[model samples]
Every structure is written in structure tokens, then in C-alpha cells.
Target: MLAAAPTNALPRWKGFNVLDFFNPDPKHRRQHTTQEHFRWMADWGFDFVRVPMAYPYYVRFDRSRPIMPHEVYQIDEQQVQHVVDLVEHANRCGLHVCLNLHRAPGFCINAGFEEPYNLWKDPEAMEAFVFHWAYWSKLFRAKTRDQISFDLLNEPCLREDMNDQFSQRSAVPKERYRSLIVKGCETIRASDPGHLVIADGNNIGNEVIDNILDLDVGQSCRGYAPGLVSHYKAPWVFEHPEHLPEVTWPSVENGQVHDKAWLREQFAPWIALVEQGGGVHCGECGAWKETPHHVALAWMDDMFSVLTEHDIGFSLWEFDGTFGILNSERKDVAYEDWYGQKLDRKMLDLLTKFV
Candidate 1:
């Protein structure tokens, strides 16, 4: 059984990240996560939905050129309303909604479009980033914490190429990262004082944030550690995705022993946060389809077991794409047809066991 957090800890929310509007390119934006997806999740004993958004996907901007700093303030009600609609639908289906800026005003984890300014170095970008939180907070002011929350940003890090694995990547100096998070939380409360806010862990969600606990905000972690197991053959993440060695569990490879013990070791920092009055959740986690099915499942089991033992909840990276349980397109699994989509039953069963 999963243990409970301290009295002040955030609710242990278990669900998947819904990619309703995640793409940066307006033309290639994914279809809105269906209403049936929400209902299915509720019926399957899940109670959380994370909507990761690309700012460009919901704003009015020139498609022919990159968005300017001033353009960040251009509010497109028609496009933005889609988020409101999905949040309400998910809430009605008994799921708490966490809205995240996967691709924010001036920074993105992936190499989608060129940002006009650096979020960490430019004052203009920082203000624009906070403005977004303020806008979203006021838009849903009437909704309580039980129905809504805001994840300030997606995995954050400082890298030369941002997307390339070979780039010079480093933590966003903790002092700077802390200030940004504090400002974001403050901005949201200025509009909706009773709202709940969560900040992804620094350094691409791999580590814990000890600085923000006193602010009454939860901290989110990731499950994509030992990238060989989670992101194998992922083009954007690995320089040579095609040459990634075959994954294995209970085996020492890449100078790292990837077994249950290593899984627990990775989670130690987040566990310390809980002891100090903070809540932890795995914000984005899953292996790409190219990974051998059985190896991926084994890694997921150990990771989930450690999270459960530590009293943490998680949101899978996505609901219906390459990393999802539905239509994952992995050749090895014997899929179960669930309402026309190929469902990975083993993955679902594993998730259910931990939940």
C-alpha cells in the first residue's frame, strides 16, 4: 500500500499527462484529448489529468515567423478556451486538472521554435512568463484546488541546443530557478489566492527542490532517469538514438547498475523533501516504444514500487501517443483492443497495481 504524506502535503494524484495542445507548431498541434479519455480514466480508478501546453499553440502570432516578446501577451480567446473546456470536462469526470506550460514564453525543453529571449537572462521574458500564470489564474479563479492546479513550467534546464543530448546542459542556477518559481506562485495567488501550485524539480525534474517547501507548493519529479531504460531510441533525447544499446533490467550497463536498489537511490532526495514537509510527484515518466517491451515494464515496476513505498503519486508522460498505453505501436506486446485502439494491457495492469 502507498503510504500517506504529512497533513500539509498535497493530494497524491495519479493519472496521465494529456497532450491536448502540446505541440509548439500551430499547424501540427495534436487533437484535443477526447472526452471519452477523461471518462475512461475515471472508470479505471484514476483521478488526475495534466494538460501540457505550448504557448504558441494557444496564442495569436504570425505562423511565418517566430513569436516576439511582445506577442506573448496576445490573448487568443478562441484557442485558449479549449483549455477551459477540457479542464471542466475532466473535473466533471472526477479528475483534478493540472495545467502546465510545457513550452513557455521564452524557454522550451525541446527545439521547436526559436525563442525571442532567454527566460533566465532576460527580464522581459521573465515578466511574460509570470504574466501567463497570472492570466491562467484569473481565468479559473472560481475553481477550487480540488478541481484545478497550475504546474508553473515543464522540465527546466540550461543547455546550448536545448534539445540536443550533446549540448552543454546544466542546472538553472538554483538561486535563479528558485526566484522564478516564487514569482510564478506569487503571480497566481495574486489572482486566485486559494489555488494550488506545483513546480517541476530543477535540472530537468531529476532532483529535488529544498528551497520551495516553505512556500506551501508541491514539488514534482521525473521517472525518465537512466535514459537508456526510459528514453531509448528517442530521437530528440539521444544523439544517436539508433545506436542505443539494448535495455536490460538487473544488469550493470553504462557504468550504472539499474535494478531496484538504484531506483530507490534515485528517489532518496525526493523522500527527504517529504520529511521536511513537502509533497513529491513524478510529473512525466515513460519509456519510448523502441525499448524492448519486457525491459521497459521491468524498469517501470521497480520505479513505481519505489514511488509507492515513498508515498508519491505520478502522471504518465502522455495518454495516447508513442509513449502511451494506448496505440504505443510496440511490436512485442500482445495488445488488447479497447474500443478500437490497441491497448497495452500489461502496462495498464502494472500502473493499476501501483495506484
Candidate 2:
């Protein structure tokens, strides 16, 4: 029999989303203050930041030929330089970074993509996807594995049916997704040994963990804590309410039924899978401004409690913006001014359990 793998204590992780880093506009790109952001996060006691990158933003997508600026797939020297500078800056400010591929070369799980790269049916698209990961693995060769990690893909839609919005039932099964994850892991490992890779569940939603646990990926899984609180308010998510009911606060119980208990149910299977597969991390979770200050705080309190209890490492959904700890409209809501009400001190305190 194999001896048990050592259980590593989950790090007390906190940070924001580094969105639009590669957008052409200087205003949007400048918003990603490599040094300033890290300094602020450190000041707030956060140790990590999730940098979401759109592949096309870095690599111009073309249907006729291989995407270019391809020093490594579509990514070029300029993009790599920016990332390296940010990583170095983060180190200077005492922050860890998780590089998330929000949009892959030919595919974006999010509905907004004009042409979603359906890997299940398109052979060329799938190859491009693999090539993209291979390129990233090669580019980040200098950084120490733990100093930076890769979130394979953000919120992989499992729906196969083109008609079914959530249907992942295409020619590719969940097993193929798992295989692709392992393949990506292998590629990364080959390029730079010991680099940590985070594999997100089927969908980056609370309900997908149970479904993921049943699939065999032959490696540790990362728990994706969907922004129910934030997204619950997002116009696109269908059930968002501008003001949550009073009952939604104190207890996880609510008329919706998908409360704390539902969260627990989602986690249990993942936890078991973690034990069996080795370990896991909560890759993403947060609430939006739609949730009133008090309700968001309450929901966060519950979220931290459960995650800490399970010894799960986590990176909050974002540092700033709709689901951000600090609203992106910092000029208007200034971090200094909104820190008291918007920061959720009580919830941050609960997160100390993980620390």
C-alpha cells in the first residue's frame, strides 16, 4: 500500500482580479498597477492576486493561419515581459500570483465570445488550445513554480449541446476535460518542473463540485467558489436581486434553498475527492455590489468558515471591480473612504482562520 501524501496547510490567500492587463488602451492597462496594486493588497493583508488574461488580447486571433506574435503560440515577448515585470513587482510587495487564462486561444467559456472555440468538435481548435498552454509553459520558465501558478482555464463549460446554454455534452466527455487538464499539467511540468497548476471544476459555479468529484483526473482538484453573492446581482445570472431578503443574512437558509447547506453539499464531494486525489484549493469566490453591504458580509463570513474548516486555499474573485474588495471606481469610491463599509472587516477576520 502507498503511504499517505503529506497534507499541506492551505495558505491564507487574498487578492483581486488583474483584469484587462493586455487591453490596448493605456487607461485600462494602467489600472493594473503592478507595484501599486501589490502594495495595496499587502497592506490589506492579502497574499495573492488572480490575474485574468484574455488570449486574444495578447495574441491576435486569425482563422486562416496560426495565431501570431507567436514567440510561444500567440503570446509574444512584449506580453511575457509585462507578466515578468508584474511577477517581479508582486515579489517586491510580498504577494503571490495565480496566472489565470480567462480566455483560451480559440475558446472562451463565457457567453460573450463571438466565436467560442468548441474543442470537443473541432480538431484544429483543440490543437491550438494545447499549443497555447505549451507556449505559456515555455514563456514563464524563469519563475519558481510556487511563486506563480497557472489556473488551467477559467470556468470550462461542460455543455455539449450547442442549444443548451450550459450543456457540455459535446463529443468530448468530462473525462476528456480531465485528460486535457492532465495533458496541460504534463506540458507545464515538462517546461518547468514543480510549477503548481490549478484545475477548475466543470463550471466555475457552486453546483459543479459534486459533478467534478465523480470524474477521475488523477491529480488534485481546485474548488471553484462561484460569486453567488456578486454574480447573484449580475444582470446576466437570471436570479439576482438588488436587495436580498432578511432571511438570506443570518442563516444559510433562504427561500431559494441554495443557501449554506447547498454550498456544503457542493463542497462535500470535492472534499472527499481531495482526500482521495491528494489536496485542493478554492480557486475563486466573491460577491457583487448588488448584495447590500451587510448581506455580502454575512455571506462572506459563512464562506470563509466552511473553506477554512476544510483547510482549503482560496483566491477571492477579485481585488477590485463589481465583485472586488475595492470597487474599481476607486476615484469615486476611494479605497480609503470605502474601506470601512465595503471591505467587510468581519468577514476578513473570519478568513484569519485559514491564515
Candidate 3:
């Protein structure tokens, strides 16, 4: 019989996402991650790493003009082994890994990339989704919950259609998204019931906390509170101005004051889920590189203040790029060259202090 799960079976997941793993460039993908990266994270006082990997990398796709679901898409065992090796590496370094599907079979937040069918509405897509998770369960069957956990999907939201326009307030009903989650969780449990599964909140992991409470799974909330501040001037952000003026920490925007109180209120739904014993995590949150250093830190302080108060852990959007503490090229902040990479000392200290 399986031992009872501890009350705190969920770790306070403070860490980073190896962004390089998400639809990486073919030529340099191999150079993106190494055992040293996990060691670096562990040494930096982080105990976890949430890997947002793309599913397309593991499945074979047809080169035909329009990709069809019926076309043979095989899971490459070799790719599976590569992920397994990464998990083992993370374990050796004393950091638990959260394996996530950033780009699943039939849906994704990205444009230009085609997933053909809708993940929530299409039967074929749902089948492929379950197949992916079931295979992962079998692959990591020997792994215990403490060593690794499953983040079934990444930033799932209500999509307008298969073409990638989505929003927090999606036309797709919450019940439909919840049902799809139930199916995915069931598939994972069928293969490996011992492992805990985490379902990303709807709307880029920002909303719909109550919807997944019935499932035997944890919930992940996005930390990009007040998107204007966190994603300032980011090209990908909707309606991003070609040139944005510097934004203040508590400045008023969109007719609402931006402050700590507001930040806390935004987390109300996730807090409610946590109160109901529905283990909640701040899965992804960070400011863009172009944002001024002082402004970003102040905004992050308020965000972390609320997270710390709630005893919730978070994984910063990344580890070594635009949003990461190390190698983050914020022009306004002075950085130290640590091991040939730019390290923002103050930023790193602030993140660690919160933990």
C-alpha cells in the first residue's frame, strides 16, 4: 500500500524555469542545459526547477502542408530518455523537478505554430494529450512524489479558436476546461497514482482557481500581477506600445491604483483554493529585462510580499535570460560578472530573501 501523503507533500517551489527547454533552437538546443545548471540553481538557494518543455520535440510530426490529427505522431523513446536524464540530474543536485508541457499537442499560446485542433474541444487532441501524460507516468513510475511532480499543462487559457487568441475571460466556459483537466488527471492517475499532478489556472494560469478544486490535483497561479508592470514594453504583450515611458511602482493605470493591497486582492482566488487544501503555487511571474531596475524591484517586492504572506512559493519566469536574476540585462542596474555571466546581485538577494 502507498504511504499516506504528508500534509506538506507539496514543496515551497521557489526556483526558475529552464526557458531554453521550451521549443529550443535546433542547433544550440543541446548547449542550453547541463548538469551544471541544476547545481547552479541549488547553489543559488533554489530548491526546484520548473521545466516548460514543448511536446512537439518528443513527437514525430508529418511535414504535409496541413497537419492532421490522424497522421502518425510517434513518441520518440530517445527524447523520452533525454527528459529522464534531466530529472535524474535535478535529483542528484537536491532540486525537485516540475515537468510541464508548455506546448501541448493541440493547443498553445504561441502563434505561427499550428496545433490544428482545440485541446479542450477536440476529441482527437484530448486523446493525444492523455497519451502524452500516460506515457510520462509509465516513464517515471519509479520516481516518488518527493523527487518529482507533474505539471500537466502550462498556462492553459480559453482560446478563441485554434489560432491562438486567448484571454482570462474566455468565451469557453470554465466547466469545459475543468472537464478537460479531469480527463488529463485521470489518465495520469491511471498509470501512476502516487505522483501529484498540477493543473495550471485558466487564462495564462491567472484565473479559474475554484474550477479545479474537485480534482485530486494542485493548482498553479501566474504571478504577472498588473501586466503593465511585469511585461512593460514586451513586444509579445498585446497592445504593447512601440515605445513606452517609464512606469512607476504604485502609479495609477487603467483607472485602478497599483499597490500592495491591490496585488493581494488579485491573489484572492488562489488564496481561496489554498484554504480549501488545494495546494497552490505561483508557477510563473517576472518582469521584462527592459523595465527599469528600481521599478521592477519595487513591483516584485509587493508581489513577493503577498506571496510570502500566504506562504506560497514561486518559480521566476526564468533562470538566465530577460526575466531571470542571473544574466538579466537590465541597463539601469549594475551587475557583477559571475562565472562569465551577468549576475544582478541585488535582484538575486531579494529573491533569496523572500524564500
What is the overall TM-score of model 1 with all chains considered together?
0.95
Q: What is candidate 2's lDDT per residue for 1-355, written digit by digit as tens?
A: 9976435333446555676463422234645555876886687677877776766555534635444433225445565677678878987787877777776654555554444446656666667767877777787777775577777776665554433344443223566676667677777777887677766666443323333334332222333333454455466554434554432454444344555666666677656655554346666666655655566666666666666666665776565556565553322232444423355444455555455
Q: Please report the candidate that would top lDDT against the real structure.
A: 1
Which is better, 2 or 3, measured by TM-score? 3
lDDT values, one for every candidate: 0.85, 0.58, 0.77
lDDT of 2: 0.58
Pairs in steric clash, model 3: none
Question: Model 2, stretches more than 4 Å misplaced?
Answer: 1-12, 22-30, 61-73, 159-172, 205-228, 239-247, 250-262, 328-335, 338-354
Q: lDDT rank, highest first?
A: 1, 3, 2
lDDT of 3: 0.77
Best first by TM-score, ranked: 1, 3, 2
